[model samples]
Target: MSGSDSAAATSRYSAFLFDMDGTILNSIAAAERIWGVWALRHGLDVASFLPTIHGARAVDTVARLALPGVDPEQEAIGITLAEIADVEGIVEISGAADFLRSLPADKWAVVTSAPRDLAARRMKAAGIPVPAVLVTAEDVAAGKPHPDGYLLAASKLNVDARDCLVFEDAAVGIAAGEAAGATVMVVTATHFHPLASPHPSINSYETMFTEIDSDGLMLLQERGA
Candidate 1:
């Protein structure tokens, strides 16, 4: 969806939840920084990890990089920390800061896989302000691709899952939103040319934003009046 599409989507709901990393923040530099270091350390295939772990959690990514008996968790964390340390290059996506600032604080929140410190670091590096409610990996027993994180964001917003909409960068995130019963908006953080994506989603900014009921905006949109 284009910027106009975001205006349209926002007019349709009461609450909005955003994903960090590829969705609203550009941390590819930070990620690549970390992964490349890990790849060098383990002599593992960096190319394979790139295609596989974009939206994946650190623990999961690490566990998947087994090299004929190499442990995944042990490997994934080493990469994640290195990535976290060199986050000087993180930046917010175009229009992300503007859109976030336009919404009411109470109506929006962030749900991300980053542990709190890393999330803060990336947000700072990107010049994106942290929201009132940020659901991190520490907050959930399960992470993305699991409905736990999305559901947690909705709960914090004090809205029903049906009333919440989510913006995401990965298939796992889209799946998680669908499971949570929130509308999912997909972005190109995971891949470029979002319009050509085989996945179905809302908005071209590739965002799913909702009004916080200010001036009855959300309600008005819902009634289609």
Candidate 2:
């Protein structure tokens, strides 16, 4: 849900947790280009695969779509390498860099489904600052929707899960954030349709404002209010 009142009501999150790919980085085109190639190699339908691919790890996605003989780990690694090299379409999500800059770096972290190396590469490619505490696919036994990554990120930031706020663009990531006991805010760029979830959402960080007041961290609407 979004509007002047909702944005005005959003304030005082202890810490910020962000999903990388669709939330902070606009890597959908790059992802589709690489995953599409891998899908064809395995004879999987791209149309059916794209919907389930976002916010999921390569290994998990490979396991879900791989043919009988396909080695999930090997295919996952291959796809990771391809994505690292295919940086053509990778770019920072609008207002991402500026929003992050407004926060205390120690109070925010990136929780991504991408592996450590790939996540780093994408952040660098998009000119987004890499967080000191990054929870990647390899850092967790499970990925989004399980809350492991988000929990780990909060722990690493030395913040309580309930005190955290998460920004995400996929249903799985949203589930993870909520499961982690944080308020989840949906980003509408990657998610084309209206969000049906209960959480508040913003189309971009451009519409939001961050301020550190005596009460702690507060996020407000730049214009909606």
Number of the top lDDT candidate: 2
Steric overlap count per candidate: 6, 0
The most accurate candidate by TM-score is: 2
Please, what are the lDDT tens digits per residue for candidate 2 over residues 1-225? Answer: 373336324557778899999899899999999999878877878998877889999898888664798888898899999999988878888888888877788889999999899999999998899888899999998887899998998899888878888889998898999889887888887776676777777777776667777867655446555
**Clash pairs for candidate 2:** none
List candidate 2 stretches off by more than 4 Å.
1-8
What would you estimate as the lDDT of candidate 1? 0.71
Expressed as tens digits, the lDDT of each residue in 107-191 for candidate 1 is 7898888777888888888878899999987798777789998888788888887777677878777778878987666766446
Clashes of 1: 6
Q: Report how far residue 213 has shifted in candidate 2, in Å.
A: 2.7
What clash pairs does model 1 have? 1-203, 1-204, 1-205, 62-72, 62-76, 63-72
- Local distance difference test, per candidate? 0.71, 0.84
